[model samples]
Target: MSVAGVGGFGLGRPRARRTAERASRKVARNVGVPLLSIVLLLAVWQGIVVFFHVAPYIAPRPRAAILAVTQNWSTLWPLVLGTIRETVYGFVIGAALGLSLGVIMAKVPVLQRLVYPVLVLSQAVPIIALAAPLVLILGFSVTPKVVIVAWIVFFPVTVNVLDGLSHVDQDLLNLARVYGAPRWRTFLQIEIPATATPLFSGLKIGATYAVTGAIIGELAASDGSSLALYQEHANSNLNTAAVYGTTMLMTAIGISWFLLVVGAEVYATPWQRRTVARRTWRRAGGESDG
Candidate 1:
């Protein structure tokens, strides 16, 4: 059969132009807005410092903070690596636990009732309180820090996943069962797609928390090379530029990790993309954008 839908049968140039337009818009929305916002924020920050004659020791100008990062990069680079390592390790451990426990709890509602309260209670306890005790128990090493990060990551992932599993489309599930579809087949086709969005939502939330968890862990107990330790020293010496620089680095880490999760979600869940030109994006020759 002759092609009809895509590019209006033969108008490939129009279709290509539309695709390029969409890609340009996507780039502007994703990159341009944030870049503009940051520039505006830095401008306001610089203005406030200069207009008020604020002391550098109290609140350094944004330029000073950026300079601090460049000047002290030799000292900061190790701390960055340390924090990233802790985040990755904790994310792996916590994500595994969350996924496994979510499945178990969904399958066994009675156990969920019994154990879910304890999990909630654990979170209600302040991280500082939990961190101190954990340090005492796990010792003043990277182990305690990793455990703390994992603790922060576990709750959100488990909760989102459990909710996703419990809320899967029952009608579809029944149809699968009625037709005698194998359990594995039903899971791969139906359940996995059902849960993919929420699961990644949980993962993204966990990723944002990962760096904060590491910072908390480091504050609780860590060697001198960690970000928390570096920040503490800077604050004690009233080096506010360095303080802001470290804070900016921490924020960057959290944002970068969250973006990594988002990229993974985009790759793993095509159905969620749900775009008009998904066919065009896939470069299917003569295929309908519909």
Candidate 2:
């Protein structure tokens, strides 16, 4: 077969392949740019501390931070574990509750009217302001941490999910009803699938908020109980490097968790991938035509 034989099926096969190669290059560029930026920033930070001869007590450098984290591994290990446990607990509980409430709010107009305003108002109230009360009511245990994480996470997921549900296509709903599909069936088949994009957005937002919630709750209840306690202690002792290290650790953990959820979203919503791919192909074909 000659090269022209392949053209019978599709003239733009070469064009499509070129487009895909360009897209892959774009993806690499996107990832590499940020990774390079971070690496550069760290290098600059390390250089500054070394050049300035910064005292470890006053302001420990990156090396000092790494050393502090490693040297105090015995003490930091337990605190890190506690924080992780609390964060995961809060994230899970909050996400579950928020998802349930969001589905209900979408289905029930009365509940939507009744609950949404209150939820919005709650967001206006600072989580820190109630941190003390949360501790007082829930005690200086894991309960408060989990509660705070859930509280922070619940709002974003609820709002996103509710919005997703509301924005579902009316035609789909009508079709479901015409077919005599049960409410649950319609919800699972039409509503949930429709809401996948927004739900994933909520999950990503909630996952990150989980860290903030855990830290706040831990700080409030800090009495040798959690990671925030140690972070606070390190800060108070002017162990700036340790503080920085722990904060970096938290950031890494949060980013990892969020990425995992995003990966799950991509995996579960293969339809979304197909839709995007189709659009991309169309766009590329049009561009090539032009």
Candidate 3:
């Protein structure tokens, strides 16, 4: 028996164990780093409040804000859900309109010229001012909130889609044409795939905007909105804990939306991960060689 044959199974066992260990470490880092960052932030916040002897009305300690969230979970949970519903409504409508409009403009140059300026002009107006009028016209209901969110979402997505369409690999498309592929096939196979990355980039941008739009809409509505409570706590009751807690919740919503879009991108573009890994491996090997 050869020496290599004798130790093949032993070598395989160690290789499999090392692979498992690496995966476990990656999972731990993903979860642990975020937790560590949050702990450090809260510790710093608590320290600042203590060191300055900050008044409760001006700024409460981190513990106070956490207690506010826990104690008011029943009331706050429903409000959070409502906010999420408004966000979803806005995102869906905005994304649909953006994709449709992007395709139309790409196909028809005259319409693109006529419509592009209007879209640009619409974004110029202050969103806060725009929200009030929408509330006045649409009334203090979910309609105004949905409109606000949708309007904010539409512009970014359209721009990204347009940019992506412009950058499709023309040489590849010409090659497909030479091979007798139909225009529809080339578009579906080449154009859409080219645009997926930028489309998701737009979605991520819109995700953050959607959160802000919902909150802005809520302030205008004056109904069961979290920001309303924040204003009341700050201006009337001088309750810093409630104010800080509300801000934290709002931040969480925005982060959640961004992460949700990121997850979609990861799932939709698996090849992107492989491409990134390949580049990293090449760079590492070059450094080692140097």
Which candidate model has the greater TM-score, 1 or 2?
1
Model 2, runs deviating above 4 Å: 1-31, 47-58, 274-290
- Best prediction by TM-score: 1
The best candidate by lDDT is 1
Error of 1 at 179 (Å): 1.8
State the local distance difference test value for candidate 2.
0.83
Compared with the true structure, all predictions reach lDDT values of 0.87, 0.83, 0.83
Mind giving the per-residue lDDT tens digits that candidate 3 earns over 1-290?
45767655655432223366877898789878988999999999999999999998888999998788778889888888878888989998998888888878887889999999999998898888998789779887788888889999988889999989988888998999999999999889999889999899888899989989988888877555555555465557777798888888888888898888889997778677543334534555465552
**TM-score for each candidate, following the candidate numbering:** 0.87, 0.81, 0.83
Q: TM-score of model 2 relative to the true fold?
A: 0.81
Error of 2 at 180 (Å): 3.4
Count steric clashes of candidate 3. 0
Better of 1 and 3 by lDDT: 1
Question: Candidate 2 on 1-290: residue-level lDDT in tens?
Answer: 36767647754533233368877998789788889987898899888878989777766777777787889889878877887888889988988988999999988999899999999898898999979998889888889889988888888999999999999989989999999999899988889888889888998999987888888988887767567777788899887988888887788778877878888997877766453454533554465552
Backbone clash count, each prediction separately: 0, 0, 0
| Candidate 1 lowest-lDDT run of ten | 9-18
Please report, as a residue range, the 10-residue window in candidate 2 with the lowest summed lDDT: 10-19
